[model samples]
Target chain A: MEIDLQGIVVIVGNYGSGKTEVSINLAVNKKRAGVDVKIADLDLVNPYFRTREARSQLSEIGIGVALPPEEYLQADLPILSPVVAGLIKNPVELTIIDAGGDDAGATVLATLADAFNGKSVHMLQVVNPLRPFTGTVKGCLKMRNEIETASKMTINGIIGNSNLIDETRPEDIYSGYEFVKLLSQESGLALKFITVPSNLMTEIDVSRFSCPVLQIKRQLVPPWKKAVKLS
Target chain B: MGKVLMKGNEAIGEAAIRAGCLNYFAYPITPQSEVAEYLSRRMPEVNGNFLQGESEVAVSYMIFGASAAGERVFTTSSSPGISLMSEAISYIAAAQCPAVFVNIMRGGPGLGGILPSQADYLQATKGIGHGDCRLLVMAPAGVQEAVEMVMMAFPLAEKYRNPVIILGDGLIGQMMEPVEFPDHLKSEPSNKDDWAINGMDTRKSTERNLVKSLFLDPTQLNDNNLILKAKYERMKKEEIRYEKYNTDSDYKVLIVSYGTMSRVCKTAIDQLKEEGIEVGLIRPQTLFPFPEAAVRETALKEGCKAVISIEMSMGQMVEDVSMSLQGKLPVSWYGKCGGDIPTPEEVIDAVKGLNV
Candidate 1:
């Protein structure tokens, strides 16, 4: 298993689109590969279940984390920090910017227009075919344009994060890969990766993915798992 | 368009782009509104981000969110908005996130008038948070300085991993002048994949990554604070930036000032020089980790009678001057508040009152 997307890779989706879960899993996967990694929790748009929620585990893996400023950690007014600019201007390989959801969440990307001037900064939009505004190609385009407008950056790539969590199937990823391929051709967005549940990976033909396949483990424990032993 | 005359606010926007920063987040505010207005259109042309947030509070946090994801984010506001951002600024510092804050200061206790003022001197330089956090505060006097400081701030913020403030008054924000943008040299933003929470992949099988600012254990917190303090101390050695005006004379009066007040002091010093009075000025560019040693040395050598601290506020910077002098010189303080700028003539009168 190799999560090779290096430096900062921003994983963004519409609200409740499992963007944070992808981000958390990505950081851990990369860190486990013996690569120096860091997870910056920039999801100030949402108050709960941000990447910072698992700071203890991330720190345990020896991966650095730069979260929203301490004062507004709970306040949640729109968490753009100066340190973000500093981080961009001097990135430490694999600097993943987990943007806010939709155009509104993507709006924070505009504040980084200065730094993105030259770099082929890959802007990826995660599409969950199951989610509304993403079920059709037109909706995807609109979401894409909105993200571009708000981020003030072009959408260079797409991630198929189509899943049903507990009920995720290999078929969903294949259909998603096909759907976004049409989108990539129509809208000029390269289908970068297809994400699936780790439990579902063995069932899916990994070779079918022309792009990379990211097997994500659920970071959150179900309420029932709360009573389980640590070991 | 060859160098259109621009206000300091407009220059901030232009300079940000020139500094290789195309992203700007801000909400409308009196006096400094031009920053948002200018960047709103300019950003798109450069393929940059410009968003008018719902409020100053939201706007600053938007900057936080953007910056955390590793981008050069900035937000502009007056005193009130800055006050709202203080909490976020502290977080940015604690989290070691780097971004720029443009504060076009205005006079006030609450909802101060939309006019030029430098009352936020204390707030800008001093730690804005409860924990141990010190920001790199840059005070820009003119539109040129404002633009230059903003360009400089990007690198400074990255170098120290701290927030930098372009602490300007409303006058600088509003006043128009000819300006030149920097021939920005592009540099790669560091490789922070180790900490940037971009996405999960299969190749690297692992649990999850977290980014936060909470240290529970008392000893651990203390250790973290010590590490932060050491970083600040290193900054004092490496990033203590300033500019001196006419200090080469056998001047008895050393006028200590910054931002717009420094310009006023410059004018005052020139007039005094014309009148054959020996008066010099020490203008600090970096307000935090201030040019304390420089001012103290000037007062110490040749027996300068007074080091007068002039500001747009009643006397925020005077405290720095007082601390720096430490009984070596009688530190006099003079200034008006609430957008009332003292003319050069009045400043001379202040110098004469000291009778140095």
Candidate 2:
């Protein structure tokens, strides 16, 4: 299926919701699709697994990545570069901002409120039903409301991403689809897409999903594994 | 379970839960916040309790309260936060409460930078708290070893009825490593019924138990101190752990290192050996009940001329290395503070400069 993701896409979720992995993969996917892509790492909370960690890989793919200064790279203090506003203001074919998880990380978006004004930004709440607080439809809606309030932006779409690391299965994707589908209905948001590991793509029934499937290449891996391992 | 890649902080948190520590109380701090974030999710799924306390000081007491009731509990923090909890840590030590604490240490004297550092070496071992209290500090070189050490921390704490610390540098906490939660490390916590203060109803005993560190009487306090001293002595006898690389051979020089710095030393040692330098390393796994005997024996080797202490701190662990050798051999130091780790090549240069 052809998934044409465009314009300014802001990805936000709770902690460990695979937002960074999704953002990294989205940038690569969009770049491979022959679109000009630039990703902004607005995650001021988490020091690990930020989009900037994959800066070299993204740059190699001809995708632009804006991050804090070299000195403040590892600091928890928020130091959003001025270029982030520029990227958001005059975005490429597709500009993705990988936000930090939870309200604490989403608050940084408030600083970019002016730049995002009058822009067709598809603020999507990425939901991993496996994580805490988002396990139920009510829980997911509450989190969505919290993120909207904190970022001063409305989330217009839902992205279902659920897996148990190397133990992920076809059923996990299908079950997670059902959970996020309910979340979409309750929150009055569109179902953007569900991510499946590239290897597991053939195992799942494409007809089971109403939205396009984004083939995920696990890039944000821990160092112990030589490469991303898919069961 | 099969091997999976995980960050050191997240892995440590999962290891604690897998080790049957269901209660976690900690405040969010960099280089170690993933531990709290991971547990905040996993704990509820496993029917465990997790809390993000207002501050490190409050979290320490929360751990103390849960542990006092005979529950296995733990917390994680960096240098400045750990220093904030030192008062409660001393109380937990004096009260003989068995709990685990993980310090993914960063550079410090104040609110230092948040990169990888081992500046807490002195604070962790020598003067963690105000009183003459000691923590059984275990340092792990990698994420896998960090997992094992955290799993073992609970049992050691119970065995001696004292607080045990898993001391790791921020690199270990931040880096991703492929690790398998070994089956051998998975076990139930020991019974704390003998001394726990779970009230008379819960214990089903006529006598009530009080767990407190306060003793206003001078003579009684001294006796308590003596008893604590004896337990520390027992730990020194039984809990010392170290790893020797190339020390089995009559190597020319001895390098003392621990935690993440030890791994760097190992890399340097490998390169030096390629050039036929024959340098050796002694990595102390337990920093408090330090491998002093192992260090002394290795340093006193007939062919070993000098001992070098390499750490992320300016020169903290060097004191321990110097004290261990007792002037039998010249003790030297090389380190970088404020979240800067020496590269393997720099370590090689230092060893070559020693002219061993």
Top of the candidates by TM-score: 2
Instruction: Please tell me the TM-score of chain A for candidate 2.
Output: 0.95
- What is candidate 2's lDDT per residue for A1-231, written digit by digit as tens? 777679999999877678888888877777777888889998888766678767877787688889888887877677879989999989999999999988888999988999999899888888887654677898888888889899999888888987765667798889889988888887789999989987798898989888888878777654223335322
- Candidate 1: give its CA RMSD in angstroms: 25.1
User: Each model: TM-score of chain B?
Assistant: 0.93, 0.97
Which ranges of candidate 2 are over 4 A from the true structure?
A1-37, A48-64, A69-74, A94-96, A101-231, B182-191, B202-208, B246-250
Model 1 agreement with the true structure over B1-356: per-residue lDDT tens digits: 22334547767887888777767888877667767766875688889988888887788788777777767778888888888888888777767777888888888768866656888888888856667888888887777788788888887887776788888887777655556676874633463333345466521536454455677888877886786788789888887878888888889899888877777778778889999998888888888888889889977878578889988888889999999998877888999885557888889999999976
The TM-score measured for candidate 1 stands at: 0.59
At residue A97, what lDDT does model 1 achieve? 74
- Model 2 over residues B28-122: C-alpha lDDT tens digits? 88889888877877888899999889999999999899889898999999999999999999999999889899999887879888888899988
What fraction of the native interface does candidate 1 get right in terms of contacts?
0.00
Ten residues in sequence with the least summed lDDT for candidate 2 chain B: B182-191
Top DockQ hit: 2
Once fitted onto the true fold, the runs of candidate 1 whose alpha carbons sit more than 4 angstroms away are A1-231, B200-209
